[model samples]
Target: MAVTCCSVCAIQQLVSPYSAELSNGMQMAFLFALFTSAFCREAAKECRRRKKEYIKCLESRVAVLEVQNKKLIEELETLKDICSSKTD
Candidate 1:
């Protein structure tokens, strides 16, 4: 009857808008997830690159210090020989 028809119309109006809103929300969520994943990947790559550079710098510094220590030992030995000769 007229009551049935009115109820059907009301249901259609409410359901249609809700369906469209749900579809739009899903699309936005998908886009956000995609962008966030990309950002995280790029950040990880940058961190690895910086870590490699830091390791290289540290190795070079250690090599220089080792060279300096060897030169100091040689100089100390020469000074010791000179002092011993003077004492004799």
Candidate 2:
């Protein structure tokens, strides 16, 4: 199949108007994708920061509970020894 100059020119004439409109639509789509990617990056950064803070908070809570547990066990042992001595 061979397309000559006349057919090429006729095709361009028919398509030129729609080609400009298509170019503008593609430009708009590119800008929208850029903005969406930036927004998602910032959101991911914030999520990472919040997760770090939450882990630190839980670590501190675990330390506090461990101390409380040791204190209660010591007090229970003291009471048991006192009761046994008084009975003897």
Q: Which candidate leads in TM-score?
A: 2
lDDT per residue for candidate 1 within 15-37, as digits (tens), equals 56556556767655654565556
lDDT of every model, 2 decimals = 0.74, 0.76
Cα-lDDT of candidate 1:
0.74
The stretch of ten residues in a row with the least summed lDDT in candidate 2 is 1-10
- Which of the numbered candidates is closest to the native, going by highest lDDT? 2
- Model 2, residue 68: distance off in Å is 0.9
Off by over 4 Å in 2: 1-22
What does candidate 2 score on TM? 0.70
Model 2, CA-based lDDT: 0.76
TM-scores of the candidates are 0.65, 0.70
